[model samples]
Target chain A: MEVEGMPPARLREPAHRVSPRAVRYWTVNALLGNVLAWAVMFVIAWFLPEGRWWSTTLVWLFVVAMLANVVEVVVEPVVRYRRTRWEVRDGRVFVQTGWLSRDQRIAPLSRVQTVDTHRGAVMRLYRLANITVTTASAAGPITIPCLDTDLAEAVTAELARITGQTRGDAT
Target chain B: MLLLTPVRTLGSFAVPLVLAVLGVRRGRDEDPWWLLVVVAGAALAVVFGVVSWAVTRYRFTDEQVQLRSGVLSRRVTTAPLDRVRSVDIEAPPLHRVLGLAKVKVGTGVDATRLELDGVSAAQATDLRTYLLARSRVAGGDGEGAPAPVDAPGRGGTSYLGPAQPETELARIDWGWLRYAPFSLSSLVVVAGVFGVLAQFGDELPIDQIDVAQDAWRWVVAQALLALVGAVVLVVVVGWVVVSTVTYVLTWWNLRVVREGRGNLRITRGLLTTHSQTVERAKVRGALMGEPFLLRLVRGAELSAIATGVGTGGRTRVLPPAPRSVVVQVGHELLEEHGPLTMAMVGHGPRARRRIHVRHQWGTLLVTGALAVPTYLLQDLWVLGRLPDWGPPGLLVVLGLVNALVAESAWRNLGHGLTDRHLVVQTGTFMRTREVLERAGIIGWRIEQGFFQRRLGLADLMATTAAGSEVLTAPDIPLDLAVQLAGRATPGMLDDFLV
Candidate 1:
């Protein structure tokens, strides 16, 4: 949430972080949608109905949309703070995060189907990447966003090892 | 062909605009309106050319196929050959004239899409052949690549993979015929022709039959007759064109080739071409389908159940086929009742299939509940007489019909386990027959819901090792369902892996 050039101490816990790309990305959707919505409300108020109720309703909507900006700004960071936690336990990756209700997801090396690493422009600047682990349950790839380079690779190798070990038992 | 699309698109757009402009100069009354349209269209032409040049890019490789396009928001999607289920080629009549065709390569990925737009027909066939070969291959098996088939004169030899290639393998495509009355183009032509006929029919030079208050009924009947006649005429003509065109397009190129191991390649196309390949190991479950109408009329279709590899698991391989061919191919292409055959190899209890047959009652009940009301409202309420609760009377009748439907579903149900094949067939209207290979089943589980638990029943779901077809016996007797699950599983991986 801070601008460039802030002290490293200004950096809070890594858990309190959002995908800088996702933040920039979602901001576009929110900003564009708000503008489009407000513009429509404005046009409707100005041309249609032609009464005080219309004008007042337009003013109320503008106030509400303006108020929504505050919430829109704070929502992701608040979410970032509450749910973000990544820990490695016994060579397996466990991610615990959810806004309304927490969900603890564990990906053991043995069950890991494939490991995918992805990065976007914003993460490039921050020297960060996201690692995704898929499994057999038809669940989406569990993405651990903003991992250190060495850590992600280590996790990938570890997961493969675990998957191999478990597969060995079945064999 | 790569150089032709932009030229062709430009030609199509430019020709009309130029013609309109020329016409505007030559003609007097239409000048002003035509000039505006020509100017606007010319501007459109420039935009299309720029976008086409900037965005178009595609690549095909041994490992994967990639496509990238879009002007404002570009997208790049790649499908790995290792995960590919099939590569389909389509040719519209326009493609026949152009000598180019479209290919859709599917890897069970979320971003699966059409790739290699408008490759030459021969190149499209070659690409399909290569991908199908790739699907049969295990990673890094370079020895048995494409040589066996390419060396056609060496017919006595066989390709390497899993199952033996049977000389009498069956593959029948009735799609060319199915498209006759059911084609989208045919439907559109019928609608358009009917609209034209209806408009022209009213002005037909027919003598007036009557001039009275009650004559309106006769007049309405005549109009209805004309409308019906128009519809039949359109359907007949459109069916003739579509079926004939499809036959010409497909029958000549019809081919079914068996390659090394258990690979089946089916290639057919008229203008825009199509090819389908199914490897034995990848074929999890094979099922036959015929909607009620088709079943009554003796028509059929086929589908494959396979794991949506790399796709996060959300796809089914449905290659439409003829009924008789389905029965023949279902037995040949995959293990008949594979992974579930051990307990029922021959004259075995077949208890699992029988239990599955019993489970059809649930779907029967549900179908009955849904259909009863529709029939009553549409069929019984012809007279607009309201008896306090007018809709309720029909609603009651609808519920009764749904009950009848459920009864039919249960009565018509059939299942069997024979000669190591586990077969579960069920349907009220159109039937579905699933054949499984006991050894191929990867895993099995017995799931219990509160309602099922209360009813002393459970769900038995099993997966094949290849992660394709998932066969389930829902709402079967708990004891039997559990027995089948255990039987189907039976240390499944121990026998297959490592």
Candidate 2:
């Protein structure tokens, strides 16, 4: 996008995508959340009186939920997988994520305080891991999720090595 | 040390003791079970205080200061002398009466707060000077050499002697008290007072007071307009008095001083004096606050954006004062005039139109919500027939107010870049101009929502460890956002830019 009297500028997509297996992992996560929400609605509907205005509302809500469940499980994961990207260069780590609302972050290696790899139970089952790069800023750690475990480990190690080579305190 | 335990214990439990005594006096013949509980709690507190005091031990070595305490599970905290960022001394009313002060050592880390809870006031002063001096030596020399022990005024016994040379930056001015009422801090105090009164209304003898009864009768007799005028007059007078008193109690004798080693020391408070020190190297920026009311009177407040200083890592450098004085102090704090005085680049017409649309939509949503409920309830017998014009009138008034707010917000939206600092201004009610050092920025975050993307706009934030963590320029053109981030921290975003 360009503004008057200013040079046109743009940010290129980061170089790497998360592992392909992330689609399956995200699908399962979304299904689990949908099931829990649907179960709560069913329980409420069971207690509600029949032939009331709310009962009809609940029936309509069920239809909406079924359609939303399809979108969440079938469509969101694929779009998220396509959009998420990350890259680590000479002195900086760049991240881009989110399907609907795009976000881009850049943190210099000299300012990096720590790096860690995390794997949840389901992620472990899928052999996927997440890497978190923390800096002194409270905007919070930059997370690259659903990477192959070995790739996550390599990224964490590389980040640590690069951050360690710098001399000043992170803050 | 042992004698201080009971005194400190009783001081903290004074309110409970009074309540217990009142309870016993009211029920002369009844069992004093609650009093026993109160006494037992006080005794437990004293025992814990004594035991903790006995176990606590702190020792300062050439390289590190270590403190060890705890009976069941001992934990030792050690901080390197070179990393020391500040040393603060505080004396509450009771502590001052006992000639004792509490010393807190900050190392620019949030978790570990090394505190000496109770030390003789004189000893506290000596310790502050000695520790700060050692930190200065270690920081300036870039070596872990032991600081000299025989420096003048370093000895613990000579605390009453002349202090180190200091340059005064600012001090409290009585003329600034005029700005207190405009600050509206007294409204908070008044609300708190009303809340407490409500909580204990039944226990008080307010209804029995003849003067209160007479006042209520007079209020009921007055016409509606006269009553409103009287209430407003009372509120304005009360607000002026309360805010002035609060300002004096909080900022009496306030002084900002620069010590020989460049540490900024701020001392203030009447009953509970506070002495805070901020390391020169840790200072990242300055924030100039111009609340709408204060701005009308051409006044502003200044605060320091420093690491590990005060709550939220911000230290008030000046109270509500003249805008010129605020600018002068800000210039001194940042050690430059360009960032504070530079002209800001506005976000242009697109951003202004975006804010107007957002605010108008908000006004429409609120009006619709309120109108639906009011319309539904208008014919109900219980509420009496409501006026037909209420909803539309509300829409007209709120729409006008929000339009003004949107215009003001657009005018306030601007950012500037100086050689060493990036300045961003935001907010409407309490507009703030933040001048943050480019060197302090650790990262950049560029966010674009669906609407923002369609408008080719983005919010650019610079993340740092000091003061609020993130400083943002909202609704700027996407290209300008990228350019600002790239130029602020050279080469940090170059690899990602196309």
Candidate 3:
């Protein structure tokens, strides 16, 4: 086992990984959007539907969704920060994520065949973009969604550096 | 030249049109209930046919070929003649009867699958002959002598033209296939026939079986005898037929002319023939397809990346060749005496085997899972409340198939990465030995998912500078997968983000 700040000798860091701000951005957006959705559904039900009463259908949907939402909310405070943690080691990059189930991914910067950045309208407004580091897996490409635009650029530069030095990267 | 595109469209629509008219005729066969649907369908089909007729048209140029179609969403594709890797003119049974054939020119160009679909046999031949000459002259440097208009077969070869003949130096042994346990068609027939019987629940109607009513008591007894007889009669004869046909069609008048650079000029055919002019630099890598049945028959298909041969990541290499020829021609293609497939076996002995086993699992699992809804609904409704054994049985059979593959993967997985070449030899059938130069490799990548991470596995895929597919090394160890990916050369990973 390796200590903090000291990467394992064999492991190499990817030039960049998903940053904290990007994780926070997606989480907040999803949370706010979900909360607004439930509130709207309740308002419509309470006002309309001609004497709408609590029923099994509503109970089943709302209760299950609400329960799931609560679980997420409870877990977010403890784990949201972790979602953005990225570590660069000597020859590898490691990232740990998930609010409910912890997930960690490590990629050698040399192996990153393609480092790309994508920006959408909403992301552009917030100066945020998604960065995907692609490897030839055949299953699909690996994407790291929602990164600061500047961070994406930095990641690209760092990846290019590794690829140049190591000559690894197949798009 | 008859425009069969229009004829094919008209013929296809005519079937339903006749059906619809019969269903809707007021004076005779009119049925009130089916009238609306029949009329609507016929009308829609006619409209579609007319619209399609107006859209499709193809043009040939000295430098390229263009096929344009679609009306509202007009689509046009142009393949530079220079980019064309191989042109196969296929004449199906019906095509032979009609004196018609289709020319499929593979440019190894893009994902659109851009192809010139319909052309006359004469037209296809003329086009093929012209393209062969051009490619030959264009050769390795790509721009050489002016392409001649007419080039004839040198000797008494059939459609191979005068230029390319299956090489005499190339090796092929048809007689050795007598002992093959895995014959391609046998497996297909056995699997297909047994699967159908299994679906009907092993209860063959006496009429269907010609004579059977007892439980498999006597059946098993006969089966043992039948297995021996079938191996001798059916399997052996069937494999002989397959190898004979393959040799005749692919290697007939077979000649391999060594050209400038490492390119090989190959042309051979039986009745409906094909001619391919390939450049050494253009071939990405070689792949050997070893179907289980083919393994038994000692049959194997040698395929390679003619990167610009066809659209949508297609490789134009060979119609399945006899194991003998595969070994022989493979040597010339790889410019090495050793088996190419064995060279691809993964690092430290078991790497390729591990990768092959793990990767195949994903395909089998996904296919099995995707059929769940069918299993669920069938059991819930018509299949009775009893547990549906179809999906589970299928999974078991799939597992059995994978076991065979595992054996092959285990025995064959050995890759020798030399400075100039990446030689991969990992196949049970026909012993697919392949050799690829490292300089020819353009792109490579490594990837790991959550499940893979948990298992501490990854994949290293390498693509030649010329081909569309990246030769996959699935389930490469995490460290090595990354190392390989990191070391992939630039320009190999074009459009990675895209």
Candidate 4:
């Protein structure tokens, strides 16, 4: 990958991993989704006539779906939790996320349009919340998913204060 | 105002009117009960329009412009005068005939408009000038107020007067019409005509018509090759004529003028005239687009990347015209020559190879998928079976086409940085060179797929509030991407950069 007169492409990882409880939350979410899908598959299988060509195909598909779901529930959450990192410093927000395919975003505080927090029923049970920092760019709001509820609130307040102090409209 | 209501009502009921007329002709002896119903509807519409007009009260103070309307459920919309971004004056054919125009006051916020329908043309012009002048003064550029020119038809008014002199930036060249067919806008028009015809296909006596059979017979009489050539020639000529007419209708009397206080006023359209005033300060960049066909002819189109303009905030500044004209207009609009005309740094051999691999892989996957189905279904139907060489032959031709596209895409893959703008050019079919102001970039997003990361490449996107929202420099060296972001914003990315 080395090239003449070209510096290596590298980005410093952001500070602070998401709340550890996010792994548990994600696991439960994945399990629920898997269970619902499996239920639908079972219902379809039950109605299938015996010895049909597709009956065996559906069974193999069911097995593959189960294996994939197992990995999603057991492995992906932990990997995502370890990879996701975010920081609000130097009047800017930096977020780095994803396991295999990574993305790093940097948005200045002056460009922050709104800050909000969300706590779903499952998130509430895990005492976790998600904070969304929005800018005028249509790329969409930056979601710092699965933080400790209090930490999420504090971050939202801090972002709101910093954005409020800036003068010009976010655009 | 009284005439406007009935005309609008009648216009909306045109389909019903036609059906009623046909019904009357079909059954002349029957009572014309539908006419009475139509009269009643018109009367109700008139009453509603009159009452709404009478109830609507609009007033402007130093701070805000307030409009209060509605008889049953009162509503008030107030926009701060200082925030007024643009004022558009439009007069459709009916409105023009009635000497009335629609005034739309934009506040730069998305989709929030204060519309005054059916105002006297003179009053609409006055409001536009007054609002724009106030916005300019309030913006505090220190230029003070523009000199007020007397309104053409109206004599002394305290609040109504046209704003300062305008300098014409560009006018319709007529010669640009040659590039219209290449633009493919007429293809859409032609498709729309066919779509409408297809919608009424069932009603038309197509099955009973012998024209199609006669055409087939006529084609059979001629040499197959000659018939194909004639059809192609006819289609191409037809497209050229249709596109030219479409271009003329859309861009008739097109003018881009720089008005006092730096506002760019774009006035165009033939039957339904439209005049849009773009606040100069809101313009963030310029986008020059060269479609594949247009590029072959050395033609390009230009657009202003501004807030609260056209959809996605891109207002066309130049119709498809000579590349030289586009470049000149782009430079003028951006107030910078380097970014638009500078030689851009290509994304290196790795990016070029990546494009080839991607396009070739895609072509292979598509052809493979089709070949597999064709092979499997060979016994089921005669048409399902391809000849021994057909699959490979199709693949080779498609592969060659994709290779050409990949080469063009790779060549177009470049980015440049000027003192004030970050320029990124990419795309194969519609090659776009975006010159985005560094100041307009609000954020940066660096994305790397697994393979891209392995290859030390990343897609660097500068997120902005202007046209398209994000401009991407795809598959640039990761370090270069970072450097571009840091240099463009100067210290914004310092802490994050390794």
Every model: iRMSD: 20.4, 2.3, 9.8, 3.0
The lDDT per prediction is 0.53, 0.82, 0.55, 0.82
For model 2, fnat equals: 0.79
Give the per-residue lDDT of model 3 (tens digit) for B428-468.
54455445556555434445554555666655555543444
CAPRI-style class, candidate 1: incorrect
Per-residue lDDT for A83-105 in model 4, tens only? 89999998999998887888888
lDDT string for model 2 (B30-98, tens) is: 766766777787787788788978998888887778888887899888877666777889888878888
| Proportion of native contacts kept per candidate | 0.00, 0.79, 0.01, 0.64
lDDT of 4: 0.82
Relative to the unseen true structure, what is the C-alpha lDDT of residue B409 in candidate 1, on a scale of 0 to 100? Answer: 55
Candidate 3 docking band:
incorrect
Alpha-carbon runs more than 4 Å astray in model 4: A1-9, A45-53, B30-41, B55-57, B61-63, B67-78, B139-165, B193-234, B377-384, B388-390
Ranking of candidates on DockQ, top first: 2, 4, 3, 1
Task: Supply DockQ values for each candidate.
Answer: 0.03, 0.64, 0.10, 0.55
Cα lDDT of model 3 by residue, A69-146, tens digit? 765655564466544455445544455445533333445555556678888766676688766665433333445566
TM-score of each: 0.55, 0.88, 0.59, 0.89
Residues A37-141, candidate 2, lDDT per residue (tens digit)?
888878877788888765897888887987989899999999999999999998798899888888889898899988888999999989999988988787847
TM-score of chain B of each: 0.64, 0.84, 0.59, 0.85
- lDDT of candidate 1 over B181-236, digit per residue (tens): 43233456557766877787688544453443467757776887987787787668
Q: In angstroms, how far off is B214's CA in candidate 4?
A: 17
Error of 2 at B297 (Å): 0.8
